[model samples]
Target chain A: MARVVVDVMLKPEILDPQGQAVANALPRLGVTDVSSVRIGRRIEIDFTGEADLDRAREIADKLLANPVIEDYEVRLVEGAEVA
Target chain B: MARVVVDVMLKPEILDPQGQAVANALPRLGVTDVSSVRIGRRIEIDFTGEADLDRAREIADKLLANPVIEDYEVRLVEGAEVA
Candidate 1:
């Protein structure tokens, strides 16, 4: 089996209200001295067997994330070698 | 300025409904052949001048992520070295 990792982040030019909200909530949660915060998304998927990495990237671009509003990267997780 | 990148993911023991929802939504959006999806959170913070990386990790542990329900990793962005 193989594990795929996906990281999704908002476009720098796009305003991130959710990120701002998390930043605002930080201090209240006893985490002081923080300057700023920007929140995004992370996803992991497990494949039953060897799969095409290129196809995974295609899925990421077409449906997993919004290319115009978000940026993403996909990689194979280490240490999942099959017997 | 220094940019701190934070990645947060659910504990292996916890069930990720949001991730499952995203996974289910994929095929509808024309992304087929996908098996699973697990979603988490990512955060980035900018620190003015040289700041303590240790303190940033502390904030990440205490506020940016829930230690009990989530795991996180923080790193400085590359190519931001000041002259």
Candidate 2:
């Protein structure tokens, strides 16, 4: 099995209200000294034996993320050995 | 200004309650056929002239993420023209 990491975020040109909300909430959470903050989503998947890297990317692009408003990337990392 | 994208996710071995909740909510959102889902965070920042890529990375590692339970990646993408 291969581990794939997916990152999904808003495009730079777009305003991110969700990120702004998080940033505003930080100080309330007692996290101070933060000048700014933006929020996005990350997803990690363990591909079954039949899935390859290309297939994983396809999954990310097609269903995992919205290409118009968001950008995403997939990184393949080595997984643990099967005992 | 340089555009930096940060992706924060739970460590693969750790159980992600947030991810699980999001996954469970997907079908209700009318998104079906998803076998699984793992939720995470993505942050994008436009580094001011003073902040370099390395500095942005430092911020991500030190403040933007919880190093113990989460892992993050920083990607530097070219920004638009200043003019």
**Which candidate number maximizes lDDT?**
1
Query: Candidate 2 chain A, which ten residues in sequence have the lowest lDDT sum?
Result: A28-37
Question: How much lDDT does each candidate structure score?
Answer: 0.76, 0.65
Query: Which ranges in model 1 have alpha carbons more than 4 Å from their true place?
Result: A24-35, A80-83, B25-35, B80-83
| Model 1: per-residue Cα lDDT over A20-82, one tens digit each | 887787677665556667788887876666655776787678767899899998888888543
TM-score of chain A by itself in each prediction: 0.82, 0.75
Give the TM-score of each candidate: 0.75, 0.55
Error of 2 at B19 (Å): 4.0
Best by TM-score: 1
lDDT of 2: 0.65
Q: Which ranges of candidate 2 are over 4 A from the true structure?
A: A21-38, A50-54, A61-63, A66-68, A74-83, B18-37, B50-54, B61-63, B73-83
Residue A51: error of model 2 in Å?
4.4
